[model samples]
Target chain A: MTGLSFRYGERVALDEVSLSAEAGRFTALLGPNGAGKSTLFSLLTRLLISRQGQIRIAGHDLERQPRAALAALGVVFQDATLDLDLTVAQNLRYFSRLHGLPPRQAEQRAEEELTRLGLWERRNEKVRALNGGHRRRVEIARALLHRPAVLILDEPTVGLDPPTRRLLVDHIHQLCATTGMAVLWATHLIDEVDPISDRVVILHRGRIRAAGDVPVVLAAAHSDSLADAFRHFTPESPPAQEAC
Target chain B: MPWLLALRGIVGREILRFLHQRERFLGALVRPLIWLLVFAAGFRAALGVAIVPPYQTYIPYEVYIVPGLLGMIQLFNGMQSSLSMVYDREMGSMRLLLTSPLPRWWLLVCKLVAGVAVSLLQCWAFLLIATLFGIELPGPGWLTVLPALILNGIMLGALGLVLSSTIRQLENFAGVMNFVVFPLFFCSPALYPLYKMRESSETLYWICEINPFGHGVELIRHALYGQVSWPDLGMVTAVALVLLALAVRGYDPRRGLMKRKGG
Candidate 1:
């Protein structure tokens, strides 16, 4: 969606935000806290409707053809949404069924996704029993069950440890590279952004602060590192610098 | 086809969740059973149940209040489903459901149907318990009352959806439930006949006459005796449609209360 704008009563939550995530590429939506990343996400996901601007998913206009648009989109929200009482496989199956997959197909897809996540062994285990990282993986697997053309994650690595976060980040990058699925990952952590071959869209207070490839964004900001470029746009505290 | 799968998943999840919470299932029963056993015992002693429309001869208070107790079961279960909706809205699980490709209204109808399905089980269990306690209902009532149970359940569930959407916070839910459940129950002829309420107060009688809950319970009472109350059926169905419409509007992103609160 381009030129999308939204508000909460009198307060403008998003102001003429415009950007497009491309196919077979990772688009990192970089924003600090309260930068309208969530609002933008909500609009993109069609959870909240913006009176201004247009949104399309996989060539389907969201407002005009919501069903087709939504069917083409898969999302992993920032909060934990899996039913804790349900088994890992059960959660996956439920999600596939929601996506309209029949029982046999839902089972097959659930198996494939769980096996890919290396969680097939623990398929019968309740989500409550899994660690944070494993649960996050399950959510990712759930999002990918129907093989949506566009995959978006809102702070998907929020509570996981550094190693787990790194693993998830790498896995998503690999998935994007291998499957040619358009990926948009929103996060405040600067370290999550790859220095090479990744697109970045920086949103500051509901407006697009910067948008482009790693080198383009770096050159545009005239900075040596992404952290510096990020600091130049957003007034967030010093991010955790990469350890040498 | 996708909508069917979505509906099944939704209903299946609701049933699974209800099963997981044994305390909730047991709690749904305790209130009605208490009314049937203890309160009915005292009420039986205090007043007599005149021969009602469904009753050919005078019936015991236990037997007469059975339908009302059944209505109470669905009412609470419906509100309970609403409470969960509020919880889902807060936990962001609601986002998970809304993201599905299926229409949102269909998803909500699935939710209402699922709640009714669970309440049907509770009502059956309550009826069994009542029989075990020596309350005699017509044997055919067990089957005849199913449709009535479903109708009342949907109407009450739709009411809950409207309530849930208007309520912004979980903390306010409990207060609203009590405020709603009590008035709807008491204002209706759940405990006594409208005639009894009329003898007490003309105003309360009019409230009972118009109360959808009253019609629902009366419908159940008539159905239990193998008779159909067309007036009650029409009233319940009309109210159900209105409430469901309101609920759908309440959840719509652009037009409903969701626009103000940001679901």
Candidate 2:
């Protein structure tokens, strides 16, 4: 998708943002906190529609063919969307059915996706019983059940431990490598970006500060480390209390 | 297929949530049951009953109040669902649902329909229990009550939708109950007829005439006796349409609902 924009009243959330994820490539939508990454996801996924720009998923315009575009994309939201009262299998089955899969096909796919996420054994467990990491895995599995050509994860590892986060990121990298599906993984964590498989886009205060290969983008600021590169783009600002 | 699936998913989630919270279901039953068994029994002698149009012969006060009790449960459930929606919005699950590819209006309608279905189920269950207490309507009247229940469900559910969209947080919901629910219920023909009020005060009669909730209660009242009132239907339909439109507008992203979260 290119040139997608959004605003909340007078304040802009995304300003003429442009990026692309070629098939089989993993693209990390990196930014600092409050850098409009979540807003961009809201725009691309049709949570908040903006008439000022265009978004195409797998060659379909979102506004003209929202269902077709949405069907082609799978998303794991930052928050756990699984119904806590439902079993993992039930949750996945519900999503599968929502995507128009037949009941038999949906059940089989739910099982397969759960197994893929190492959640098959816990399929019957209610989401309330699962830990934070396990619940996130269930969400990822639920997203993949429809087998979309593109996967979008918004801060997928926000609450996980370091090892679990690395494992989740590696799992996503492997999925992209094997399926040739495009991936847009949004996160503030600099270390999550795979130097080989992903391109990086840095957003600052609703604007893209840089976009390109991770090494090249990081190199532009005379910084070898991704963390330093991120700091270079985003500097701490003094807090100003609004006049009463 | 997608629509059916979406409907099922939304409805299933609502039912599962309701089932998990056993207290809510029990409260739905107990609240109306208390009003029927205790409150009604206490007031039956003090409250005089006149022959209303729905009554062919002189019916007891307990039988006359059943439809109103049903309306009360539906209204309370509707508001309860609104509270749940507000809580979901605060908890971020609402964003998950809104992000789905379905049209915003369709998703909202599905949510309202889910609430309606839950309210209807509770209504039916209450009725079955009430039957055991020797409160019975005409055999065909039960069939007639279906349409009334559906209409009342939509009206009340639409009101809940409006509240969910407009209210910023679940914590502020008490003000809504105090300002909206209490007044609508008391001013309406649910507890007493308009003519009964006209005897004592003209203002009360006027308030009942304009109270849309009264039309909903009257719809149930007439339907329970195998009667259909065109005026009540018209008023309920108009109110439902207006409330639903306001709710859809209130939930529109550009205006606030979702955007207000950051603020």
- Best-matching candidate per TM-score: 1
What does candidate 2's lDDT look like per residue over A71-114, in tens digits?
Answer: 89899988677788888887777677567677788888888878
lDDT of each: 0.88, 0.83
Clashes of each: 0, 0
Q: After superposition, how far is residue A188 of candidate 2 from its true place, in Å?
A: 1.5
Q: List the pairs of residues colliding in candidate 2.
A: none
- Name the candidate that leads on DockQ: 1
Best by lDDT: 1
Alpha carbon lDDT at A11, candidate 2: 87
Q: For candidate 2, lDDT tens digit of each residue in B232-257?
A: 99999999899889888877765646
